[model samples]
Target: MAVLPGAEPFRHEGGEVGVLLCHGFTGSPQSLRPWADRLAAQGLTVSLPLLPGHGTRWEDMNLTGWPDWYAEVDRELRALGERCSRVFVAGLSMGGALALRLAARHGDAVAGVVVVNPANKVHGAAAHALPVIRHLVPSTKGIASDIALPDATELGYDRVPLHAAYSLRVFLRMVDGELPQVTQPLLLLRSPQDHVVPPADAARVLARVSSTDVTEILLEQSYHVATLDHDADRIFTESLAFIGRLAPHAGKEGTATVG
Candidate 1:
């Protein structure tokens, strides 16, 4: 399938500390391009990969599943590990669940994790019917571009593929089961008024994760896609600060300052 023009994957080579960013389901790398660029500017090697079923038409996503998406990010993570001394994973929504899965599977190899509006479980009674709905219908409304900023927009599919969404629920369930195994330091940024991912999703992760160092920051002015909303600066600055505190030696060589 031909990829979208602005949805291409982004890669930047910098120091030994690498940051792998994962965009949400149905969203392309465009969603996290700015964030990846900011991290790269700080002399940190950064990669924002477009998942297997994403960055193309919505119909393409229907042909893919969770494992396919996970495989792409896992490949990037392994590649980053080979060149970078330390590596961290940051994701949005479904990407966050993938990050947790990596932490659970890799342990200390993942230096830390950052998630914004992470979704671990689906809500509403309709979620219970995903299995049937996926077979009956091909798609429904999309959950993209849920930003509080009026003019702000996110590059994602206009329709939600039921088969792919069902796969996401299965993936989330798997990640939830492995949450207790995630012991790496975690930074979670949440928006209280997020319409796409409910606050309960974040609570479920916080309660299950075994991480000793967990920081939860509330983004008052943003929505589900907080990375592109009003509090985007906070997410970027706080993420840099989190990386600095955890990988102090990694940032010493770079001129980037968190302010």
Candidate 2:
């Protein structure tokens, strides 16, 4: 993968376990930065890569597709595998889809997965009907509208590329078929009040995934952006514990080996 001119390299703390943290669609690494910092403090190397066309202008997202996003994630996951004894993945929203896809394709390499408000389906018929609007309307770059993100105090580009959304739907279909292939321990953090992805979808994920070692934690107060909401701390704590358990050094390390 050719390094983008301004993108941050995959971040790694000095440790044996590797983690890749992916942010939501059209969002920056800024969303996951706090969680990444906390994980690094616990001595696990973490990578937070900007997906294709994200962290820049929203118009850029129109040019890129879901495959591009997955390709970038795959590159970072491979890089983490090269450096650490064990690798894990965590993602929010669109990133969650990427994480699951990674686990499906590289199950042997990923030790565990933490998914926060994964977007497996678009909630309603309005979204389904407006599928063609993205093609009709020109993407308004960096348009911040409050309606697009009601729970989130921060707003993102108001306009979405319809074709991009359509592409994302196709990616979801692919991952749905690939779900049973992933067998790693899963920590699903979902929000009941999530305006983006419904609770039913989370249930569907838990049901479909073949992993026997799956735990679902419901977030009552937060919406889709759980990373920055009331349950954010819970996400941090549980995710750390989850990663800590699968860590290569967890029970194997002697007291003197602690870092």
Instruction: Please count the clashing residue pairs in each candidate, in the order shown.
Output: 0, 1
Regions of model 2 farther than 4 Å from truth: 1-10, 126-131, 139-155, 248-259
Error of 1 at 152 (Å): 0.8
Once all C-alphas are superposed, what RMSD does model 2 give against the true structure? 4.5
The per-model lDDT (C-alpha) reads 0.92, 0.75
Writing each residue's lDDT as its tens digit, candidate 1 over 193-241 gives 9999999999999999999999999999999999999999999999999
> Residue-wise lDDT of candidate 2 within 56-154, one digit each (tens)?
556677788899999999999998899878888999887898999999999799999999988786545645654676667754333221122346443
Pairs that collide, model 1: none
Residue 164 displacement in candidate 1 (angstroms): 0.4
Which number leads on TM-score? Answer: 1
User: How does candidate 1 fare on TM-score?
Assistant: 0.96
Report the Cα lDDT for residue 184, model 2: 96
TM-score of each: 0.96, 0.86
